[model samples]
Target: MGFAERFPRWTSAVLAIIQLALTAVIIGLEIKSIFIDLAHGTIWVGFWASLIFIKTLVMMLFITCCCRGRCCATYVLAWNIFSGILACVTIYFDRTFINDPCKCYLGDKLCCAVRSVDSFRTNYTSILDQCGQAIANNDKTALQWCSTGSPPYDKVQYLKAQLGCAVGMLISCALYVVIYIFACLGICFGHD
Candidate 1:
């Protein structure tokens, strides 16, 4: 069957086009984050490497959006929004995690800390449990128990900064998913 026959009408195809455009935008933003070739001086965020984990997933969802299904496109859109928010949150957390003076640098800007793969690995490993405990309660107290330097602002503020991007991604993804399904059921399936 032709593409239109599978879904009827050209609306699915049209939606697919819009989704594709959005996917392109997301990918472009991701790339821009990584490389700024201009001599204008790239302001590198100290802990950017940690953001790779979230961005990789986003890239996958970007690829998925190139599909032919209207439903699939919608799924991808939803996925993209969710993943984007998630990515942002994860990246934010990563940045904060990296910037933590006690945990990360261990020295002045000019000063070097234990500078080795093994040392880095150990640092991250130590904090894994802390992150988990924080997640268990979704509250800052649990996070503080894990440890952040200074006082009042340390735990909750830091956690909020980290989780905020993640929460944003979650909200966007959820809305996109719901919209796609609703559109498919109502418009594509003829219920609407």
Candidate 2:
């Protein structure tokens, strides 16, 4: 009689897929940060999220093709609980990255006034070259510019996206647990 009892079976699969996609997005964003040398707190988040994602994929395959009955439901419930806990932990780490300002540097020399991803990509080499020249010549104005810069658009956006995806995965896992509980109960009561 509960909402989960009436929920479509396909919905569980859909939720699992959503969680998988979200985790992948978080991982991809983290990889992007790593490539740009902006990865700080994201490293942990990415590592854990990747593990959860892979296990979820395997679980989904097992459940879809092989799992059956209340035992399978119990297993699913347990997995969801585990994944939910991981998502919570990742979210906590993700918050630290989101709250911190973006730090972009070339061998300890910070880029100046670079605000957007487009600006970073288009002018990074030039900025590096200019900073190097300024350093060699001890150009105070250029050096000051190199030292003072805003957060990069790409990093900020990636962190925000990762946070959002982590939250989504958490919600999906909780939903899966609820659905599996009702499924197990329904099986027990011969209402399945």
Candidate 3:
């Protein structure tokens, strides 16, 4: 009897839980990026939106596998391998996507800057209002102030989020491949 033959039943269940968690996190990050992209009128809205959908679908499949237990090991392994590959591709695309607040309307500049301020995470509306007044008054320094703020703009935060998700997804992908290999061995050796 080898590792697969002695593979405990709880491992699969634990993996399912982990898969659920990774999928959920990825979905949340993608949705957040999508919102920011939409507000900034980014050309990549469709791509990010699709990522949310894909993560949601992957979560659903993970739940199904969890409910079915070890009996569906082969199928689960296949699904995870595919999902892992998809996540890798998603990460690559996310890392390559351009993030720039200047691309949005001028009115959005202040909001973008305020949103990037980690301390003012919730007071974005007020900051935007104040910035809007300056813009309306034709304040020449307003653009300079907003653009050169300590936090810069929301694009920076959005890029951080994308990078975080991509790193997490990449780890999940490696874990999935490892689990899939174990499952393959277990099945081939007729381990229960």
Q: Write the per-residue lDDT of candidate 2 for residues 61-147, one digit (tens) a residue.
A: 566556644566566768778888888887877677667544333333453433334556788788777778887887756755522
TM-score, every prediction: 0.33, 0.65, 0.50
lDDT of 1 by residue, 17-63 (tens): 44344434434433343232110111222124224423434433443
Residue-level lDDT tens digits of model 3 in 1-192: 444344444555555556556556655655565454343323343255345435534543554544434445455556556665666666555555544443444354543443433335677676676678777886656644534553225454665665565566556556655765776677677776
**Clash pairs of candidate 3?**
none
lDDT of 1: 0.40
TM value for model 1: 0.33
Quote the positional error of residue 160 for candidate 1 in Å. 1.5
Error of 3 at 115 (Å): 15
Q: Model 1: runs farther than 4 Å from truth? A: 1-158
Candidate with maximal TM-score: 2
Which stretch of 10 consecutive residues in model 3 shows the poorest summed lDDT? 37-46
Evaluate model 3: give its lDDT: 0.52
Best candidate per lDDT, number?
Answer: 2
